[model samples]
Target: MRNPKKYCEIWKLQKSFPSPKGPAIVVKDFDLFLRDGEFVSLIGHSGCGKSTVLSILAGLTTKTAGSIILADKEVRGAGPDRGVVFQAPCLLPWMSAFDNVMIGVDQVFPSAPRAQRRQIAEHYLELVGLADSVHKMPAELSQGMRQRVGIARAFALSPKMLLLDEPFGMLDSLTRLELQQVLLEVWRERKITALMVTHDVDEALFLSDRIAMMTSGPGANVGDILEVPFARPRDRKAVLEHPDYYRLREHLIGFLEGQDHRKPKPVAAEEPLAISAAVLSPA
Candidate 1:
């Protein structure tokens, strides 16, 4: 068997915040390694610092400890090499869908001719099934359409890594499924390394090469990492029929259930307060 090439590495990542009551550690000793063109999903209970991990990986948040190495370079801050799609579409109100994607392409490929940049933008938009809505504003588009613009904009950069923080958490079931398929198609085509923080177990099973299950925080860490054995061009119906699917599903569901029953440590009066999920910024 061929050895997988390492693309990104996270070692002993930790994050903490100062609270009035004490220093609350939200993430502790979290570690993960991604191979080139691999898709990994981080799954955990709400407030288990899932988004915090992504934020740190995106260079949006500073880690209190450990290291994040991408392509052999230490990640200190955000760069064009990493593209992030948040829960909200975050499209600029005035920019049309085409213009929105163009901004990212221009930033990442500044030396390219203007025509080429525009073409890149248009190509990604079409890939996401938004060819006709290229000129539509965010307000004019449906929620799902707006998110599609965001996805296109991110992919237009052709980043080495993509960070997704619950990008489909807000959509309706049908729209979520549709966007998931679109995202999978794009990922298959580009094969970019992706790390997504998702609460959906089925979504993780459908999309990731491996699922990193985290324990509940006041210092959450990876509790289990499960390899997804399903073949590519994965069909939802076919996935449901696979015998291991239910076994994996039940394992993930049971893990979260156990996490839900674990209580967080209490904060002391003299120390800084514990970091609540509300305080952490969305990636």
Candidate 2:
């Protein structure tokens, strides 16, 4: 791995892309200071450029302006150092859970022996509590199970930074919480630097060392970086009961709600299926 301290030394990064209907997302004068192993979650309305930021970080999309530095190297194109997990699990339906993870290892470490690749995948699956389901196909798994496969795949590569675009966004409430626990376990164990984009205030509070709240659309910029001071091993019950929980949640909600004089679009009787589905499912 490259030197993480050198990665932290640069400042004032920016990115944007042209859209026929104006830029889909624009980040201006953005200054993000990230440490070696910290977890940061980005939160904003749907179109506030959360995923776009992840794309820029992953080197999957080009930045119209500014720059991105990972470890000590400037990101030129998609590199093995950053692993991205999308909102959808995006598993190969034909592949088993274990194979899905092994595929990542194959791509990132093609020279590793087949047995070594299997060992790495199995380790991550066991870490995520999916060892029993290793051989199950995507079709046989629940939404959360599919995402657990995704998580195992991403972590198995041992990426320097894990970029998560609401990886649990499609799971039900119970499944979401269950995966959150699994994620915490993997995150703590690996000490991987992570950046996650999410809409859920509670979920952000649960997983992040800091929550980077963005402004409303068009010219969205980061508004606040709220630090989560609660110590780990953080327990779900204890975190909920922490006196600071409500305060921190309300602060994030207030920023997101107050941005652009917009209220969260109410769940009408007939929204688009994908949008509707995402709202009900937390990830």
Candidate 3:
């Protein structure tokens, strides 16, 4: 879509982290822009630093080089303006689902009254189809259910941008598909700018407006940004039936397969609020 006010930008980005053997793992030049209300996916081999990029965006990790700009403003540190949903759900095992989501809302709006925070948290939980599970603790919920909480927490804050790092990777095939649909519905309803890191080609095609393909390893950089021209309210089965679907899918598959044959790379290394109190705090 056309550029708008809520867009997120990553300019000439580069990063490095301490490797087991020596200095930090080096990530070469990278750059991209996330338009307001756009859904984009970052897809690449395991060592391509996708998660590292997410960390930088989250302000949990510092970049050795480059800059992140959100809505025409340079991003210097973490704040409620951006929300992140991780792969593991990262919930507190002892806290109930409502409390878990409440934590994030709290950070973003610390001064808001308790009742307001509770309402926001519950609303997001309901949006993610987890109204009944609000009282259940993380330990009591299934993996998929736990992930729903993570999604609920992120969207509850109404941040200008949402970052998802393979949040559905741990779920079964069917559950993953269900969550995918849930996420799409939420995005359509909210129209929040979203960036997701995923290895699943089908998932990327299903969820993203554009897919950024990255190089294989060690010094991974953005290789291509392919736009998904499929019509809005996309049909999974019908899209698959379309001749272009396979072509797009194959192109992504070929890039990933080529990365699989590349030399190995070094390893890399690495929240929130209660109701109003949670959303505005440091992660």
Candidate 4:
């Protein structure tokens, strides 16, 4: 958050699980370049290994091949610098929302006294619209509220990078939209480098600076990267009305259709995607 300049580089990343025939590759040659404070979403059909790639970056899964570097350091096992938010809130049922967030703040700020750490937790919890629910236990909160805590905890870390795997996938649509707005508001404060894995096209278009589309698995990889032209302080209504919004949406759907084994592969667009974002931005 201080520098507002963090970089994540993934090169030739691959993950494979042993199979009777041979190694079953889920992700292969997955190269991604994330700029400082940029939000990038990885979207593909379910089971396409988008989460696999994100997990690798989060240091939760071992890569069968390739290298991952963040802040100029190679990613090994899980580290505090990277915060992960999954579909589930993953909170401690016994702890209050505030305590759930405080546990992380305490670990990251061990030198700080309880009062200071409590302040950190309170600030983020309030930011996520959980100010009144800070003292409530996980079971006492709704699913959406629990996720709010997850988001709060992640940002409380002030992590160099954030890895989110379908953080909103399990929520109801209304709750999802509310949390998305909360996420945008909080993220705008620091713009910490973030990578999210989701299949929701509207969700990606509304929130991301760029969208990374993945091919079908086995051996899924980034097939294209679309540069979003909508200006920041994004309004959902304005983004939906943007001239290029549907075009970009169609492009994403087209890519997915092409990768769908159930149908014939889609022919490439007549316009070369490399021309500019007006056409498309291939990765």
Candidate 5:
């Protein structure tokens, strides 16, 4: 596929939290960009602040400094246009699968008729293979099934940019592969810009158009970028068989290994979203 125009531009990104010792800087001076409707992944070892970047983009977590521009306007806080699926499904337990998804669809399409909103929710739930389980409550569903609902909910809003933070991190190997395929099928149809954070290299390789490598933290930032040369509309089998697959894989492994020596166990500090009310608003 030909290159798409610049869509989401993140420049000089920085974040820090107050520490007993001092301010703990997690990310600093991070710069990156995504083409319109492109699928990109931020890959790094744990504690590298990859999730921090995604949260900032989602407006769930506020940045200490810098700017994120999406769809031509500055991103001040979370809105319906950017959909986020975190490591955990984060669904409301009381709500049934259909209602879980409807929460977002209703918010995003409030002007539409009630029947239209129901149609939108059912469409994405079916798209994610949850058509049979639409009425099940969160406690009644398996972990993978819950994540599927989260994916469906995110897409139900018809977001312009989708932010995923280790979306498959909690699943079993078999289930992980299953969800990966499901995610791609839905994404292919939507053609929305997506940015995912993950530590799994092969998972990144299979799903991303380009992978951004981050340096180790206390002040993590972009180390390098690898363009995934595999043609789009891809499948796992074809990607594994493609020439140069290992070459790209090796480069990512090599970069991470080099950063391992400096990698401290990630800091366990959560800062209050105590900035502007815009910072505390949900994405």
Candidate 6:
């Protein structure tokens, strides 16, 4: 009856790193699809190539094989359509928070007037509760504040997708939760598609529409995809109270533990492993 809408698709994605010993495959046959305005999280053990997948999707790192299609266009390299925030804030030490954000807005909206760009930057900074710190440099801001600036900068670009690689991994638990709330608020308002790579199960459950569990690497792919059944805008307390929350949390933890026990496969100089259609299903 109705045609399925595909906002972003990753087909048979693969990535590898060369070494004297052999070519180590970091990601193999990673396949995923995101509908418009959906938020997904990738969770796996450390070094499972979770970040590699995000980098490939962001066009920051080239995939050795496969393709990434966004809005029906093949991703070639870093483009304005995708915005990234990494573990470290990675802000310029010399620039003020406002300036750092304005630079990105300027790049993405060059045709707009300077005044309009400034307004856009201010709007996002204010959205992230950084309006007062707009003039402060990265060194002057606390770790959490600096990360907020990074978030503001990314959002100001108005990208079609937001790629977060453990953006809150470096913060304290309290700060991490606070930033999560800020991110949730913005995401609810903008409804931008997002893919986050995180090791935090609670964070993933709290923020994602679906969680993609990656298998262990030298060649990792999505081993399972679990939908988050909680309704949003999600309240932390309420989500914890939901029966499915703990069930899903336990399931994810169990999956990670299982991966820990599996013997890692040796690196091979051949094509990486391919993900099966069944494993990629969002059900």
CA lDDT scores, all candidates in order: 0.88, 0.79, 0.81, 0.86, 0.88, 0.88
Candidate 3: regions farther than 4 A off: 1-6, 18-24, 264-283
For candidate 3, lDDT tens digit of each residue in 1-283?
A: 4358337878767676565755454455667888778999999977678988888898888888888888878888787788889999999888899999888899988999999999999988998999888899899899998999999988988998899999898999999999998888777779888989999999999888999887754555677778887877777787778778888998899878876775564344320011112111221
lDDT of 1: 0.88
Per-residue lDDT for 189-259 in model 1, tens only?
Answer: 89989999999999999999999998888777788888999999888889889999999999899888877
**Candidate order, lDDT descending:** 6, 5, 1, 4, 3, 2
Residue pairs in clash, model 2: 168-283, 169-283
Clashing residue pairs for model 6: none
Model 3, C-alpha of 226: deviation from truth (Å): 0.8
| Top of the candidates by TM-score | 6
In terms of lDDT, model 6 sits at 0.88
Clashes counted in candidate 5 amount to: 0
Model 6 TM: 0.94
Candidate 5: C-alpha lDDT = 0.88
Candidate 5: 10-residue stretch with minimal lDDT: 274-283
- Tens digits of per-residue lDDT, candidate 6, 1-283, equal 2213578899989888888877888887888999889999999999999999999888889999999888888899998789898899999999999999988998999999999999999999999999788899899999999999988888889998999999999999999999999999888889888999999999999999999999888778898889999999999999999988889999999989987887776677753433333234342
Q: Residues 1-283, candidate 5: write the lDDT tens digits.
A: 3334668989889899887856787887788999998999999889778999999999989999999988788999889899999899999999999999999999998999999999999999999999999999999999999999999999998998999999999999999999999999999898889999999999899999999998777667888889999987988999999998999999999988877865364454432222212221221
- What 10-residue stretch in candidate 6 is worst by lDDT? 274-283
> Candidate 4, overall lDDT?
0.86
- Per-residue lDDT of candidate 4, residues 1-283 (tens digit): 4233338888888787876655666777788889988999999999888999998888889999999989888899998789889889999999999999998998899999889899999999999999999999999999999999999999999898989999999999999998899899999898999999999999999999999998776666788999998999898899999999999999989888877854322223331122122212253
lDDT of 1 at 246: 93
